[model samples]
Target: MPSRWIATFDEPALVAQALTALADLGVPGTRLVSPAPYRAVHLTGQPGPWRAMGWLVLGGGLCGLATAIALEVGTSLAHPMHVGGQPVIAWVQFGVIMFEMTMLGAGLTNFLAMIVLGAWSRRQVAKAARDGLRSDRLTLAIPTSGRSPEQLQAIRAALVGATGIEEAP
Candidate 1:
């Protein structure tokens, strides 16, 4: 009773057509699996989560930069270092440290968000789809969680019309 179904098509163009037809029916979570990279067969209808992640990365970088500046300034003030009457907060000397910390914060935040938010677990590769994907076939996976029997029939009809091989539920 898995809540997913797949339809394999022979041509990439057919896959695109099927995707459009399914989208018209208001299908939400659809995926395309192909033997090679094909630009024509995009299936996901949801707005991607990358934009939010980019904001998070930017925040992390800013926090890291602030932390780096504070550390340098605080240490210099705690232990008076008057090297040739240089300012306590030497931006030039600490620029590399700030850059390094910024990168570290962004990297760590990206990794943690991917793991915790389940962004890394987006796609599930079935064995059948994997085999076909390595060959010369394209598969469209549609989530059938709350569809009616009539909707299912329409989906099957669309797949058959697109010269798809079989429907697996």
Candidate 2:
């Protein structure tokens, strides 16, 4: 049920226009990949790291703090062994474990976050499609499992207004 058909354009302006039109038409899973970055065709309407990633980072930080506090409290209370002239609850030494745990939490958060977002998933060649556009050319892709005849015709017409149209099977 996964397939892609790229709609090509010669200018970035046309790419953006068609993208906006298609999006307004309620097309889902649309993408635009071009040699040059086109600001207008961006569909996600979100910039920078996703909100979910921010939540992951915040949660990881809190978990790291909690672990560090638990370790420091439990260790100090159970076995109070003084080192040099410092008290048994010496924060200087405890800072090492805190730092290490914080780093570990952050690393694990990033790894898990990537996995959750399917960032590392392999691209199936069968579902991949492309439209040849020049470096100066702008393009868009509408990923669909089943496109209606009317929808396909509309997409073709919208793209044709810019440069040319090509659909992949």
Top model by lDDT, which number? 1
lDDT for each residue of candidate 1 in 1-169, tens digit (9 for 90 to 100) = 4576767777877787788788888787777777776764445554556558888888888888888888888888899787877787788988999999989888888888777665344445444554556466778777777788999878766665444544455
* Residue pairs with clashing backbones, model 2: none
Backbone clash pairs for candidate 1 read: none
Instruction: Report the CA-based lDDT of candidate 1 relative to the real structure.
Output: 0.72
* Per-residue lDDT over 13-120 for candidate 2, one digit per residue giving the tens place of the 0 to 100 score: 767777777767777666665676567636524333445787887788678867997989787889987778788877788888888888778778877887766443
- Regions of model 1 farther than 4 Å from truth: 33-42, 115-137, 145-150, 160-169
**Collision count of model 1:** 0
- TM per candidate comes to 0.68, 0.60
Off by over 4 Å in 2: 1-4, 9-13, 34-41, 44-49, 70-79, 91-100, 120-126, 130-139, 143-151, 160-164
Q: What are the RMSD figures for all models against the true structure?
A: 3.9, 5.0
Assess the local accuracy of residue 7 in candidate 2 as a C-alpha lDDT between 0 and 100.
60
